[model samples]
Each structure stands twice: as structure tokens, then as C-alpha cells.
Target: MYSRALRPCLITFQVHGRHFSSTKQNNRRVTVIGAAGGIGQPLSLLLKQSDAITNLNLYDIVKHTPGVACDISHMNFPAKVTGFTGPDQLKDALRDAEVVIIPAGVPRKPGMTRDDLFNTNASVVRDVALAAAEVCPKALVGIITNPVNSCVPIYCEVMKKAGKLDPNRIFGISTLDLVRASAFIGQAKGLNPKTVNCPVVGGHSGVTIVPLISQCQPAVSFPQPELEKLTKRIQEAGTEVVQAKAGAGSATLSMAFAGARFAFALIRALNGESNVIECAYVMSDVQGTKYFASPLLIGRNGIEKNLGLGKLSDYEQQLVKAAIPELKANVATGEKFVK
Candidate 1:
């Protein structure tokens, strides 16, 4: 279990060394916007088990939100779980939520890009985001829909129009990329994957997802040929899972873990603990863009500090330079969708 009680400071949040107030203690509600799909199902399961969560709200456009809630309710977890289905009840589902995660959208098919999945998922995300603004404007919103490079902007546009947009309270969930990067790189290096904590920055998509290998903790080494092979593998890790599922699903289980880690950190921040830091995609002015993803100092209210891209190796620097075009395009795509 990740701890939500880590020392709360403006320190960069780490998944290690954390604790949560789980004993019928904290009375905060966590609502998952899309709690029925491949990612949402397992992601909801994880959240239901969170000590920081006293109540859990499951919302979905699919007709099965109630069933999903029924299914997850069997778990002997302490948190109260409720399901809200269809459009009419969306606002009610978000009521009084402290944390609202949007994992409610389409998953990628075998040959689909995140952008391809966005065409349908974008509308889905917007509708939920609109409800979030109306019912739980103060909630920390964690977005997990596809083409997050774009959907996050869609959420921002919704909240902005509703006049409830808070950059610090909003985040794009790119932790999966970081998880996959660490796992793939650790496997390539024959090291334990748990020991690898590679912070992936930039947007979430094909080339837009850039992993900063130079800054991997505990210091891992790969030769030139190995570096290229490993980087490609890390970059393409999602594809490996998608192909492995063979049309059954995308990377849901691992994404759930990453999402939980993020949630735990937020809970820790709320608990007034120190030294809780994690890399997440957030609205950033660290560079030229209105938003960028990097390591952030998450505090009680929202983002405490926007840690700019740290010093990268020559190879990593090259990746950052190469990724700008893709990142900018992805950001543009999301912005246009909202417009």
C-alpha cells in the first residue's frame, strides 16, 4: 500500500515512502468519471481500496455504471461506492467530490493512435468535464482519457468557460508512460523494474511521449546500441501491451497502479505531509507553452512548483528537441477540439 502521509513539503513527490489516513478517518469523496471500461474498471477497483477515499462515485455514459458499481461493491473495502449512469445524472455524481478522475473514454484498438481514439472520446470527456465544473468545482481533476495531450485541454476549456478552471487542480494522467518506460528500461538492463523511476514529460501519445533516461534514479547504464533499442522499446511499450491483448484491451492494470500512486500523493498533499513529489503533466509555463508535463511539487491547494525540465544528457536533449513539434501539434489538436 502506498503511503499518503509522506512529509508534506514542496519536495518532488516520490511513490516510495507514503501513507494514507484509511481507518474510517478521512471523509473525502473520490469520483471516477468513467468507471466501467477496461481502464476504468480496474482503476476504480484500486481507488475503492484507497484509505484516503471515504466515498467513491462511478460515472459512465455506458448503461452499465450501476452494474460496475455492484460488481466493485463486493470488495471488502471500507469506502462507499456509488454508480451514476447516463447524461442526466452526471452532475449529481460529481457532487462534493474532492478528487475526480476522468478515465471515461474510448480505448485504442490494435492499429489506432491516441489521436484516432480522441475523435469519439473527446466529446465524452467534454460532457463529463462540464458536469465536474458544475458540481465539484473545487475537486482536483485527474484526466485519463486518450490523447490526453488534447483531452486535458478540452477539460480546461470546459472549466474555463464555466469559470471554474484551476490550473493547479487539473492534471493530465501520463503516469502510464512513466511506468512503461521504467519497466521496459529495467527489463532491458536486467534490473528490477520497481527500482526504475523514469520521469516521462511532454504530452502523451506516440512521439510526444518523451522519457528522460538521463535522470533515472539509482543510475542505470545502457550502451549506445542498447540505448536506441531500449528507448524505442520504452517509447513503444503501450503498443506492446495493445498487441499482446490482441484486440481485447489496452494497458489498464498498470495504468491503474500509476493512477493510484498519483492519487495517494494527492491525498498525502491534502494531509499536510511533506516530501511528496511526483512527475505529472500539468499546465506549465516552464517553457514557451501554456502547458507542459514534468516533475511537479503538488501541495494542498494544487501545484506548488513547476519544476522545469532538468538537465538532460545529449541523447535526451535530442529527444526533447525532436519531440517539440509533436508536443506542439498534440497540444494544438486538444485546444482545437475544445474550441
Candidate 2:
């Protein structure tokens, strides 16, 4: 799945029984803001393998950030790895970054909802957005910090205030929902999870997560009750991890994989690849909300086009309808935080 998802540096094409190798160098500077955190560490490791990235900057307030970077540097990837510790060096980490991914912030404990993470993560996102606006205003930003339904709005509001808001370039990394949906659907149907494609829309939270099981690629079907059960499982999969960890951590490895997958999609698009589509939470008018996550065609300048929600099954329709109010409230909470 990783190899297929991430484009390597070299490609061989065959023509008229002759093989040719094309070595296209994709040199994009990528920064992982919370490099020492649970998600950031694994995420940085995954990004290192992508030939699309030329520089991988890992930054954290933790003193061990440089150690993490040093550890990853030994892997012998083409991308050069650097670490910046403390707020004093954040500017250096973000400077000229083409893609900025923020997986920094606290993880949800066993009993805590994503909303419970708001106070701390919101502040962290706001500060990082402010720095990004000052240093790399045009960089593609992916917010992985939680209460994502709100944190994304907070990041946008900060950028907007800085007169650097480009709605298309800033994204809330909600690929985990899509990943979880695909995995659950695949397990139930006995298919390869990598080949299963499911589009999860709405916001990235409890009730706001709406999976379009009816529209899954390969056209999978489920009994109505089974469909509802699968959808609920996808929605609450993060909590499942948190509980299973017994408060150790929350969805770090899976979230890192999902975050890396989404980041690579953005990198591929930025490198002029066509039809690079992925779902991300971003400022939008879809579903009468300020921010929504749906399938998007990513291009060099960011969102090329938004493929809005397609034909919805009755159950899917109800899920979306039920999600609106909660999504609005989350957006309101985020927007209010910026003010």
C-alpha cells in the first residue's frame, strides 16, 4: 500500500519492446511540526521514504527533537532530515517549506473525547499557523492536531487574519476516517484493504463523520443493520484505539500512516501529477457548513476541484443530515477560538 501510494523517484516505461528509465526529481521541502510527538515520529519516518520530498524538517518544543531527527537521518533516504527544537528554532524549520504537516498536540486519553483536546491543541495549532503565515504563507498546510473539526477552522482563521488565507492550501488531515472505513469494510467483505476505496465526508469527529458505504469503489453492499454498524465503528475507531491502549496513547501509528498517505497525495499533486484526489477537511460551503471534508482533486496550486457529495443512499443521507448541527457547532467553536 505504501509503495503504491507514494511515488518513488524513478519510473520505467516500456515502448515498442524498449524500456526507458525516467528519473524525475521531485524536490519539495516538508516540515512536520510536532516531530517528537506520537504521530509525528512515525509520520516523519514514512515521509522520509518518499522521493517526492527533498527536505524533511522535524520540529518540536521537546528537547529530544534533534535526537529524533538524528535517528531518522541514518535511514539513508534521499531526503535530508533536520530537527529544530523549541520555539526559537521553529522559524528555521518552517522557512521555505512547501508542505507543512502539523501532527503536534496531546493525544486523547481513554475517557476523553476529541473535544476534550480542544483547549491545548487549539492553542498549539493557532501558534503554528501564525508562524507558518509569517514564514511560508503559500505552503500547503495539513492540520493533524485533534478536535480537527475545530482546529482546522482555528488555523484558517489565523491565516485569514494574517491576510494569507488560501482555503485550498490548508487542509485538516481526516484521511484516517477514510482509512478506517476502507479497513473495516474490507475485513467484513474479505477484500484487500488497500484496494478498497471508501469516501468519508463531513467533519472529523464523533457524529460528524459520515462514511459513504453505498458509494464505495467496487460497489460493496451490506445488510442495512450491518451497514449501520460498520459506519458507527469507523466513526468511533479512534476511541477504540484509545480504550485498547488503556490510556497509553491514541491512534498514533494508524494516524501517522493516514497522515503520511494524505501528505504524499499533496506532494504528488504539487509535483504536477494529475487526478491526485483525496478527502480533506477544509473551508467549504458543502452541506451548508464553513468547513467540510469530501473528495477533492488536488492540483499544483492546491484544490483543483471539489467533487461534492454524490448520490447518497437513504441511510447515508440521514447520517449527513444528523451530522450538520454537530459540524456547525464544531466549526463555531474553532472560529470562536481564533477571535
Candidate 3:
């Protein structure tokens, strides 16, 4: 059970100066499993700009995967770009990878829900997880596949069966929900989105996406009806983009940006940066669910601490209550798929 009376403590860190290093031991390799896809390409591009990565491995079954890696390699960054196409090359791509991010999967059409993407994306995630288990079992893995609520569990189940399960290391990338919540709240309150911080919890799906506007860093208030509308918009932002694109795509650009943000945060944490924090869905006892998304304190070993849900409003409490059953069903779906 969550302690509704507890408020999350703010963490602050100071960096006196910036330092750049290129030693062999300092090298960090990151792998993108679906590098040629809509989210993967842009995400790989963003990560290529990072100084923390020494190698970026882009893997996909598509012939042009190497081409995508080549395109990103031209950029003047520290990370060396490598492309691995098809199953035969996946091991090479994941070899020595410190962090692995999976954005490989199909996108949603106008009327499709994230759950509708389960069959295709779940298999993609499962195959990648199997390879990761064999090649880089200890690497920090981030799942960006659709129906993330289920796909995350599939990855975990695979890793568990392989006897390499690390609940702290595997995460369902739910940062996009927080990103949308902050952006929507900022838009509604006429505040700079970057300045607004909203903690989105629960699973990554329709009603399961709970944005704690009451706990937003800069306190904000809205009429009850307005609050409901804002929450709904944040929950369905992906669908809004899908409908806007008219079946062409589904929130690829923004999802890429959010994915890159989460990946960078993980990199920072792995580098032993202090006070690093982010929200992600992972195996937890919080909220009595097998998996839940909440603010997490990221450390050198992945999740150093699970910052449990703090001080929910009555409305927010109800939202969380409504989410549990759906989350359980989603978890069951993923676990059943693997079995």
C-alpha cells in the first residue's frame, strides 16, 4: 500500500565543472534493437549526440539498418555507430552493450489501442529479450514496444526463465506519459512546459496512465471538469497523434524524444551521477501490483530506490484504484504470452 501522507523529497545536485573522457574503461556501448523503425531511427539520432556513449549499436531485420547507422555515424560525436541487420548479427550488436533499448515494433493506427499492438510487438520484444539474456544478461534494458504494460512483463518473464532477472535493471519506458502530463499541464496553466514537472504513475495505457497534477512540482489547480479533460488528453495523447496522422504514424517523433530522455537518464545513473531520478514501470510491490510506474531513484545499479506514490488527491486516488485491475490483466496477458 502507498503512503498517501508521504511527500516526495526533492533531490538537488551540483556539477562544478564538465569533463570529457575517452578511455577504454570509460567506454559505454548502447544498443537499439529496432534501429530502422519510426521511433528507433530518431531515437538513435538523438542518442548519437550524447557524450556518454562510446558505441551505438543499431540492429534490425531491415536491409537499411546499416544505412541508418551510417547516417548517424557521420555526426561528430564520441559514440561509434555500428549496424547489425537480421538475427545473425543481433548477438554482435548486443555484445558488450551496457544499455539496450527496444523501440522495435509496429505503430498504432487511428482506431488502434496500444493493447491492439500486443501480438506483433510482444513477439518482437520477446525475441530481443531472449537475445539479450544470452548475450548481455546484465545490461540495463529499456522496453519502448507498444502495449508496454504487457511487453515489459514478457521481457521480464523471459529474463526470469533465463535465470538473469534483475527487477531493478529492466524497465517499461513510461516516461512519455510523464512527458505528456507535464506538457498538457503547462499548456493549460500557461506555464513553460520545461518548468513544469508532473509525476505520472501506474501502467502505461488508457485509464492506467495516472498523472498526479496535484503533486506537480509547481503547484497547480483546475476546476474538476477541467482537470478531468486534461487528464483524458494526457492519457490519449498518443491516439490524438495517430488520428492526426491519419494512419501514417503514431507519435513517433515525441516518443523518440521521450525515449532518448529516459535513455540518457539511465546513462547518467550508470555513470554514478548522484540524485538521478525518473519514473518507469518495473516489478514492484508498490500499490499491490506486480508492476507499477512511479518515480524511481536511478543509481549505478539501475533502481537504487523505488519512490512510492506520494499523497494522492481523492480524484487521483480513484484513478489509481480504477487502474489496478487493468494493470493486472495486462500483466497476466504478458505473462501468459511467454508461458
Candidate 4:
């Protein structure tokens, strides 16, 4: 379940045009790669429930996607579901899609870092991203693939090579970190988690994930020791989930929820709504890093504006400084993999 503040209900807008038939005329066509995976299934389910989505396409290397699609189609939601399996069907799945989300990759194990999952996942993301480029070049692409710090650049590289790269439309989903920051801080202060909005920036791995708790909305303060402890815990939350699952899985459900939340924000933006904002990792110029996560204003094009990291406390500034090297190395590894 998501906090009310975190999950807004779907909004429908009236439409007028000789070319349009129903309210669904303007809704988006969304495609999900790796739709049978732990994260993809729930994310698809959430998107299926949204009134803003008119058609949902599911694709995966695994053959189970049809069964997942068949099951989800039984739901009464307005979004029609279709499943595509294997590389042969990839183009069909991506065709006409306005929004494409990739969460396909191997899950992380207890002792492994995100960088460790890069070998298998990088190719997975690259192939899928390339397919999107060939078939749905204008789609707003949201990548939830592991080792996002690297995979995002890998995707960008592929898109660039194809000459279909729309810098504004490519995004790395880092909302899970923001979700964790708000939840943890709210718990610590006995405030409503739903009311807590924490802006998380930097990159999407280990120490690179920076939670700007100092800029939390409805401002609150923490002792220096507690602040340091909370920051570390937020940074390592993914590992904590991996260890807690005893190697059976990574953070699937919560991640699905977070991915859905970001995707919906995109859908709203595409619907011509204004003032929608969320935190995302994208090709950025913040702090001279090649790609950074910052508060982004989402609109019909994708990232309407990059709200650079607002003022950071000395400690938070140090966190950003420490993240740049690792972030750069990860990004280079991805770019190299593409070449």
C-alpha cells in the first residue's frame, strides 16, 4: 500500500476533437519490458489500474509474460493488456508505445553490490533500450534496471548511437530512495510519512544516493549523530532489504510501488498537466557530474526542468562530493560496455 500523499488518484480530462472518440482517446500506450519479473508484475498491475493508461503491453525473455498478461487482463480496469515474448516479439511490443519502462535484469543477492549485477543486466537493458529506439523512438523511457547508475548511461549511449536520443525523455527511476527517506524520517519524528517529502539527489547506488533531509518539507531537525545514522541507513536500504529477504529476493514490492509512482507522474505530465514534480536520475550538469539525480519538473516532453540540488548542509555537501567519483566510474563502465 502507498501513502495517500505518495499515490494520487488518477485524474481524467475532458477531450474535444473530431479525431477523438472517448475519454480514452488521449490516454497513453505504455510498454513494460520484463513484465513477468518480481518488480514488473506489480508495476504492471498498478499501471493497469490507472485511468491515464489506455493500453498496456508486456514483454519478456521468459515465456511467462502471456500468463501474467492473461491474468491481469481479467481485471475490470479500462487498460487493455497484451503480452509479447522473446526478442522476435520485442518490436511488436514496443510499437506505438508512448511510455516504455524497463525493469528487466537479475536481482541482487545479499552480498552483492549493484555494480556486481552490471554484467548480465547491462546487456539486458541495452538490448531492450535498442528495441525501444527502433520501434518507439519518441516514447518517454523510464529505466528501473539494476545498477541504474550504469544502466542509464548504457541506455543513453544506445539511443545516441541510433540517433533517436531525446535527452529530456530518458530517466532513471530513483524514487525508491526518496520513498525510503520520507518513510524513515517520518518514523523518526513521529510525523505522518504521507506528509513527509524528502528530496533525494546524487546517483542511485551505495553512498552515491544522497537524501537531502535538511530540506525536508514541513521542516524538522535531527541531532548530528542521528542525521549521520539516518543518512547511512537510507543509502544502504537496498542492501538491508536484500539481507532481510535471506537471499530469496531483492526489494520487489516496494520497488514496484515506487516505479509505478514515477510512471504515473509521467503519465500525468504527458496528459498536459502542469506543476508535476518528482526526483529522478537523468543526464544532468549538477556538480559537474555527467548524470545526477535531482528534483525534476515533469511535463509533456519528459523532464521539463532540472531543479538542481538546493542548498546542502556541510555533511550533505560532503556526501555529494564523495559520490562523484563512484558515479563517474560507473557511468564510464556503462558507456564502455556499449562501445
Alpha carbon lDDT of each predicted model: 0.77, 0.86, 0.85, 0.85
Compared with the true structure, what per-residue lDDT tens digits does model 3 show for residues 254-306? 88878887887787778776667788999989988799999888887899889
lDDT of 4 by residue, 141-173 (tens): 899998999999999999999999888999999
Candidate 2: list runs displaced more than 4 Å. 1-23
Better of 1 and 4 by lDDT: 4
Note the residue pairs that clash in candidate 2: none
Error of 4 at 182 (Å): 0.8
Off by over 4 Å in 3: 1-26
Cα RMSD, each candidate:
4.2, 5.1, 4.0, 5.1
lDDT of 1: 0.77
TM for candidate 3 is 0.93
lDDT of 1 by residue, 1-339 (tens): 012211221123232323233323476788888788877888888777665677988988899899999989887766889999988989989998888888877788799888888789899888887888888888888888888888888888888989999989999988888778777877877887776677777777766677877777646777878887777777777888899999987888888777776776777677665556676777777655566788777778878877767777898878777777777777788788878
Q: After superposition, how far is residue 42 of candidate 3 from its true place, in Å?
A: 0.7
Query: C-alpha displacement of 126 in model 3, angstroms?
Result: 0.9
Candidate 2 lDDT tens digits, 1-339: 212221231122232322121225558899999999999999998888776688999999999999999999997667899999998899899999999999999999988999999999999999998898999999999999999999999999999999999999999999899889878988999997777888889989988999988778756999888888898999999989999999799999989888887887777778787767888899999888999998888888899888788888899899999999999999999999999
Q: Estimate each model's TM-score.
A: 0.91, 0.93, 0.93, 0.93
Q: Which ten residues in a row have the lowest lDDT in candidate 3?
A: 5-14
